[model samples]
Target: MNTTLFDRVSAVQADLLVTFVPSEGAFPESTAWVDGNADGQLSQLRESGVFKGGLAQTLLLPSITQDFAQPVLLVGIGKDAELSDMQARKVIAAVAAQIKSLPYASVALASRALVLKKRTQSEVTALIAQWLNEGFYNFLGFKQDDAEKATKVTDLLIEGDDEAALAIGTATANGSAFARQLGNLPGNVCTPNYLASKAQHFGEEYGIDVELLDETKMDELGMHCLLSVGRGSDQPSYLIVMHYRGGEEGEAPHVLLGKGITFDTGGISLKPGPKMDEMKYDMCGAASVFGTMKAICELKPKLNFTAVVAAAENMPSARATKPGDIVKTMSGKTVEVLNTDAEGRLVLCDALTYIERFKPKSVVDVATLTGACVVALGSVNSGMYANDDAVAESLKAASQISADKIWQMPLNEEYQQQLDSNFADIGNIGGPEAGSVTAACFLSRFTASYPWAHLDIAGVAWSGGAAKGATGRPVALLTRYLLDKAS
Candidate 1:
């Protein structure tokens, strides 16, 4: 969507204003407004059943005789004391969603974000702009491939003239588009081979160096756990590594791990349901890493980093690994597969172990691993389980600043017991209860040897129908993090 920026409220055909007030405060409008109760304020506007607190209300097309400068929209952001960045983003989303059915036209947003914690103005503007356009994205690739669907909004107009905000919107739009490209691509085109090729593209386009380890090479390295999951698929699996030496040469590189399960049919434990095709997004975690790598290049940090992506597809057949099977990981840990569907951990285990070879100063991995994570965090917060508090604290701070909140869950010793196997060193899955925590525990074992964090992104990977595209581009949060730490 095209977006324009202005210094303040402008003389136009449409206007949407975002306001902040104190708790129990009466409704206020900067310009003239219609009161349903005939009362003087927006509270009266709410009393008339016209609008609730912090919501968007549509003013129908102006009557030919109605005298108006522009179609006025007063969006209440609740009391100023209760104002938050999320509320701010949601208010903008509501407005943008409303215009989806209307004609294609430019709509200006007259709003500002509170600079809490004294965040740099550029960071605040960039984050807000990214989220605003994020609301207009949706994945329609699988929907009969219809390209004629015209967006209700052709462009967006931010209220302020701050170059920072404009840059923010542009950067976010690029990120969102990047996410949609990955989220919408069919799994076949996003397999380990394809992803390795994508890494090469990243290197060529951005001057990053990418290394690809094929199945034969992985087999030689004793990555049986990772290979076992991909053995059933005709498509070969691979290990993808990209090095970004933005800092002085020989600097310690921060390592990022991504679980790139291109398509998961549960191997021997196949999934049965309509719309299973959406499983193509199984690789979104890896896609986010690729996107993050590019964004970091664009937002160029002074620190160096390396990223490892374990990219594979899980398909069931005679060659597929089954329940009750045992395999050894690169870390020399034996895993008994209790359920074929629990394959994400299998892939991550080897990937995390592989990162150890790089001897990264610190590590973090992203994955859409567990359904239990969806139950716990829903569509908003991503589940974060970390082995180190210092890393977790930095991540939490970055999350808050980036408006990509992650809630940390306990990764205690007790959770690890669930994965202990009588016949093997560990079980791929623990008992059903606390599946998310158990999965974190499983990953925690591999990470125990390093300063690491795990973000179980089952919930936040896709925004559902709530956002334009199901992909939310979660990397912005961590990107903000590494930049702060490295800088």
Candidate 2:
């Protein structure tokens, strides 16, 4: 898809024209030409109560005159004062849903008509581009029919002059689309080795450096805890690394770690048979890392960045690590595996310890680590835990800008007691209470050397039931954070 910016509405020409109208007032001036060309059809629709410009309200009209653009779309953005970035995104989503299946090859948006409170024109423009791309995303990889795989709009024209904002929005969307594709793949196809190969491909295409550590190498480096999680499966595990150097030499790089359990069946503690198919989405955190790195490569930001993925698969078998098994991490700390299902933290702890060699300025790890987070925050917000308040605040700011919601959870030392073990230095699973907090506490033990934050995206990573697919979350949040840092 191609996105182009136009400075004036008169100069725009497309198969369809999209204009936004506020509920409380008359139509914006940008729609004047269309209204005059259509012989007041927009006003007629409002008068007849066919479209009143309510929030997310939409009305489509056919071409009445030769001069008017065919099939004009009027989307309601509610009142001017109540308008926000999130609301703007909702409006875009509504518009995308309305036009995605239509036969239009090109569409133009009257960007100046959207007046969001406390947001600049550039911000609104970027939001429009980002959400439109996201709304049109459909994973038809497994679809057999050609009709289901046909393309929608091929070109999008916006009434604005901010090309930089347009680029950022489109690049972010491209990265997210990449993440969603990887996340939607079946567990058998998207294994640890597959993820490592994808990282290598990304490195080659984007001019980054890539390295992969197989199970033998990980064992030599004392990553027994991480390796133990994949022992049950025939598939090999990997420690995948990628480096993006956009800043000055010797600058301390920001590190990103992802828990890459390609398919987690709970190992010896086998999960129930029902809904096990969704386990393929366990690697969404790693997908986000790949997505964010792709966006960074496209934008070429002036910052050094490193991404690490602990890729593995957990299954129940003879060689699988059992309950009560104690394994030593790369940090030389001992962990008693009280439950094989608590494997995300096991892989993350060793990866966190291993990244210390990079001497990162700060670290943020993304994972679908706990169901407690889903129960606590639901699917609306990702649960966040950070060892440093400054890092937490920075991520919150980025979340606000990206509209990727995150709620910070308590990381108090009080929860540390739950991870205490009788046989080893710590236990992989905490006692039933505050599971999310204790999981964060476990990862916190290894991240003491740097400013660290943990994003528990178990809830927002994917949907279930009818809308079962990855959301490609936190990619936007992480990209925004890096962009802000680079600027």
Candidate 3:
């Protein structure tokens, strides 16, 4: 969508004019002209309790004036003091949902109507654009009927002069949309090779350096633990790397590792048949990495960034690794494959070991690694595990800035005992209790070489049931973190 800025509401021209109304206050001065032009219609609605400006409340009215010949959408944002960043995001989401199916070609937002506490105009502008784009997103790639698709707003006009903020917001949203598209594809269409191809294409488009290590090269590097997970699938596993060097020469890059199990069927220890199709979203962690990289490429942060994806597929076949199998990782650590279902950590362990070669400034690995995370935090927050306090704090700050909820989970040495095995250095699965904590502890063993953090995104990666699609989460959080680092 095209975004333009106007200085005054009177000068704005669009198919729809959107303004936020507080629960108990006069309309914003910037929108005063709108009320005057409408001949007290807005006040009449408020006086009649038809539009009291409660949070997420909305009212639509016809336009009879020549100053703006479009319908006005009054969206309630509640009190200005209580308008937290997440609440503002929800308000914008509501607005997007209200107009998603409407045939409006253009929409104008009264910027001054959004007066979020502790947030600057630039931040508000960015938030508005980012959430609107995200809220408007729909994956219709496989849908054959055109009529079934909803009409989308083509142009967004904001009453402001923050083009840079608009750019950042738009880039972030585009990145998220890209991730959602990749994550929503069926498992058959989005294989490990497909992810590698996507990475190569991303590198070419963004002028970054891309490298792909096939199963042969990985085997040569002793990535047996990673390779063993993909032994059953015909699709080859890959260690895909992309480097973005926007900083000075020889700078230690911030590394991002992603677990890319394109389609996980639990291998020899197969999962239940119900909702098996949702396994297609197993690669969402890798998709978020791609999304973050895409945004970084667009924003061009003055810091080197490296993305590593361990791409594989897990299926039960004659060649699949069974329970009790042990494989040595690239780090020379042996892992007992007690449960094939816990495959995300298997690939990630090798990737974490491999990332130590970069001597990275910090490493953050993203993975849809556990259902225990979903059980613990539900769909509200991604589970975070970090070895370093500073890294954890930084992510916490980023989570606030991006309004992407995350709760830091414990990674105490106590959890390490659960991963112990008599036959190997460690075991892939740590029984049933605190499954998410044990998974993080497994990855932490390899991350000892660098300041590292792990994000278990199993809960927030995608929604099930009627809204069964990728949410493209944590891209906003990751991008904001990188942006802050660059600043």
Candidate 4:
């Protein structure tokens, strides 16, 4: 898709032109291009009690202008109140969905219609582009029939002067689309090897240094905690690292570790039969990291960063790690596997420990870690746990600005008592109480070397039922945090 900005809304020619109408106010300045009765259509509709410009409401009318051969879409922005990023996303996404099936070749969006609340034009622009791109995304890679073919929006014209925001928005959306594609694919096609290959390809294309540590190397390095999770699956596990050095030499990089359990079957502690297929989304944490990597690579943020994915597939087989099994992590800490379903932390713990070699400035790990997180935060917000208050505050600030919500969870030392094991240094499962906090407490043991945060994205990773698919979340939050750090 081609996204650009223009200084004047009237100067651009498009098959569709979009503007906004507030419930209690007149049309925005961007609608001045419309001439005669067509320009007054919105008022007529309102006067006739047909249009109220409520949030997410829209009305389409034929254009009377000879300069353009298309219609005008008047979207609602709710009262005259300041527009929030989440509101803008809803409006833009609704608009995108409305036009997605239309036969328009190009569309022009009036930037003036997007009223800024506590955000700048650039932030709003980026958000608008992100939602549009995400809404246009289709995961038909495996579909052989053309029955569900996707239609691409050829040109997107944002009526504004901020091209940088346009580019940033497009890139961020592309990153999200990339992650969604990865998350939507079947486990057979998106295995650990496939993820590793993608990392290598991304590194080669964007000049990032990529490294792939195979099972043998992991064995030599004593990453048993991570390696044990993949032993049951035919596909081997790997440690995939992507290094981007956009900052000065010797700068401590921000490390991002992702639990890449490609297809989680709960290992020896098999999950129930129902909804087990959704386990394919277990790697969404890794997919979000890949998405963030794609965004930062394109935007070329001036910051040193490293993304490490503990890529694996958890299956129940004769070779699977059984409950009560003891495994040693790279940190030399022993873990008792009480429930193999808690395998995400096993893989993540090793990777977190391994990243200590870099002496990272800060470390953040993302994973579909626990159902307790889903119970606590639902699908609306990701559960965030940080060792440092400042780190958690920074993430909260990013969440506020990016519209990707995150709720900070407790990480008190009291939670550590539940992880005590008679056979090992710690137990993977801490009974059933405070499950999410205990999971974080488990991983926190390995991240004591630096300021660390964990994002439990189990509920927010993907949707279920009729509209089931990956949400490609937390990427926006992560990208926003990185952008803030870069600035």
Candidate 5:
């Protein structure tokens, strides 16, 4: 959707004009242009209890005069002094939801009177645009009949002081939507090859350099640990590397490693039949990487970054890597595969070792590495484990700024003992206790060369029930960190 800014409601030529109406019918200064009978109509409605103007309450008043060609939407925003960014976003989201259901193709958000506590006008405007895009999102690509699909809101006018905020927010939201689409697709359709193609397209369109390593190249490069994870699947695995050089020459880039198990069937270690379909979302980490890439490409910040995705499919077959199988990673570290279900770490470890070639200033690997992460943090926050304190703190600050919650989990020596192997140098699966931490510990062995952080996004990667789709999390958080670094 195209988002533009207008100074006043009179200047908005859209089919609908949105105005925030506070409690007790306190008219916002932004909507003061609706004088005479139109203004009186709103006051009379509030007085007669036709509209209470309570928080989240909305009223649609038809325009009687030709001065404004659209209807006025009265959105309740509670109190002025108490208005917060969260509340403002919620209000805008609610408005956007209503607008989506309406017949109008164009809508304007008159945000001048919004008293956003502790937030600048630009920040508020940006957030509103972001939420509006999210609210208006629809995944109808697979719908058989296009006639049943609702008419999309194509033009969004955000009446605010700063225009750049709307642009930034829109770009971020678009990236997120792209990630969501990738996550929501069935695994059959969105394979590792599909992700590789997407990466190549992104690199070509955005001026980034792309390199794809097939199973043959991976074998030649000694990526046996990563290659082992996809041994069961007919679909060949790929190591996709994307380089975006926006900084000075020879600058060490920040590296992001994603565990891309396109369809995780647990191989020899089979998962329960129930909810197996949701395993298609196993590639959400890679999807988020793609999302962040889209965002940074749009922002074009002066920072070098590289994203690597170890794309594979975990399936059960005769060729599948069985329990007790041993594999050497690119780092030459041996690992005993006690369970095939614990494959994300296998791919990520090799990728982590592979990333050392880049000599990255810092590295953060994103993955849905364990169910224990879901048990520990639930769906509220991604579990974070870092080998370095500064990397952890940097990501935490970015999470705060992006409003993507993350809790730092312990990666102490105590957890490392659980990963000890009897036959090999290390075990793939730690014996159930502190499972999330041990998984991080497993990957930490390969990332010893650089400042590294692990984001276990198992819980917050996607929703379960009716709203089952990717959240495109941590992308916002990751993007914010790079933005801060670029600045």
Candidate 6:
């Protein structure tokens, strides 16, 4: 919405700077490759040298520098062959992130040509634009009025061949903005009803299809597990199902599920008070799916996919479901609620059960489901667990290419044992030992009929520092994987 940013990126020329494109496996030069200015000697920068870590093996820039009219920035590529399309997007994002911080009036980039058959410059640009915006994102929603406001990034430049770069630039800006919208909304505003409304608008705008099930509809269909979480709150729950049918008519749609806990009080087993406000973002897993569904419409992959979000708010009240309560999931399995805070698994159980009706070939669910994941992996990577080895490997391949980190965690029979209950088929909270792994195990019960995987995004969904909104869009990795797989 800031017009200054729009003017800056649009008015600037892409021919101002130089980019170093190194061969595969090249390290940055110890010093800046300063070109001698009009003085016919090394530029003043060399005499007064600067260290921006531009040429670092951050993979945002190519190894060599393209000498243009202004500054030269050296970007590193760990390997050349591995410099595929997804990596290209990652480099563009990193480059755009760095560019916003520099004092340059404009900059040019000579990164590698991203080679994908149907992927156009427009899509590439959209991706870079999205990444650039996200790279400099600041989450000031929770800041006190007396706190100093953080700086906003204004100047930005995208460089490449004129036609492709310009096209990519515009799309990136739009896609990033789309992503930001999902990440920025306060949890109350992005509730199940709110998300359903957004989905309808996104569907009409992009020519996709959205089917949202209201509380009454969910009750009619007997989605008790999902309904159970929202029973505590005055706000009703919803299952938002969106269809993106871009593949061949008969191709099975790859299904995606998101945990849509808009606000989590941990129910009777409340989350500790330290950073409880972040409960608003507990729905980020669902937000990512919703955002990715929107972006996929713009990207238009050659695959049919259904994204389903079980969105709701979890609050503790006299009517709230308490620990020791047992409820039957849509899958017809009963789960004993061991801890009220373990409600994400309850919501996801029903969503996973509903996917059986679709009978898709693969399923992946994302949720900010567990704090144990944060303790184990820290905030750097989302913990990935799977029922199928091949599916997990494919996702890992996608994660590496995207650089939005994910690491494999055990989801074995042993973990299932941890969720055992004497009075029910399964228990919501796994005993505290491998809490995250146990939560995955609990969800796995409903997903047992499908070759499914789970992403516990608890750690990756947000950053503790000043960045505004959700940390970054991790769904882009999954979207990229599905796109690559379909192509």
Under the 3 Å rule for N, CA and C atoms, how many clashes does model 4 have?
A: 0
Off by over 4 Å in 6: 1-44, 47-107, 110-130, 136-157, 161-180
TM-scores for all candidates? 0.82, 0.97, 0.96, 0.96, 0.95, 0.78
RMSD (Cα, Å) of model 2: 1.4
Candidate 6 lDDT tens digits, 1-487: 2211222222345423434333332322211222222231222322333322232233222212334244445444333533455566566656655655555444544332333334554455545545554554444556585134443334444433444334333433444445455656776676778888888998889888899899888887778878888888988889999989999887788998988888888878878897787788888888788767765776676899999999988888888888899888777788888888888888888888888988787999999988899999988788999989988998898776455688999877866777779999987876769888888888887877888989999888876656535764576666666766677
lDDT per model vs. reference: 0.73, 0.90, 0.89, 0.88, 0.86, 0.68
- Give the per-residue lDDT digits (tens) of candidate 3, residues 30-108: 6567778878777777778888988889887766567556888889877665577768877998898888867788999
lDDT of 6 at 56: 29
Model 3 alpha-carbon drift over 4 Å, by segment: 66-68, 79-81, 146-151
lDDT of 2 by residue, 396-466 (tens): 99998787899999999888999999999999988889999999999999998999999999999999999
Rank candidates by lDDT, best first.
2, 3, 4, 5, 1, 6
Per residue, candidate 1 scores C-alpha lDDT tens digits across 378-415 of 98888888888888998899887777879998888877
Candidate 3 Cα lDDT to native: 0.89
Once fitted onto the true fold, the runs of candidate 4 whose alpha carbons sit more than 4 angstroms away are 35-39, 65-68, 145-148
Error of 3 at 185 (Å): 0.7
lDDT accuracy of residue 149 in candidate 5: 59
Better of 2 and 6 by TM-score: 2
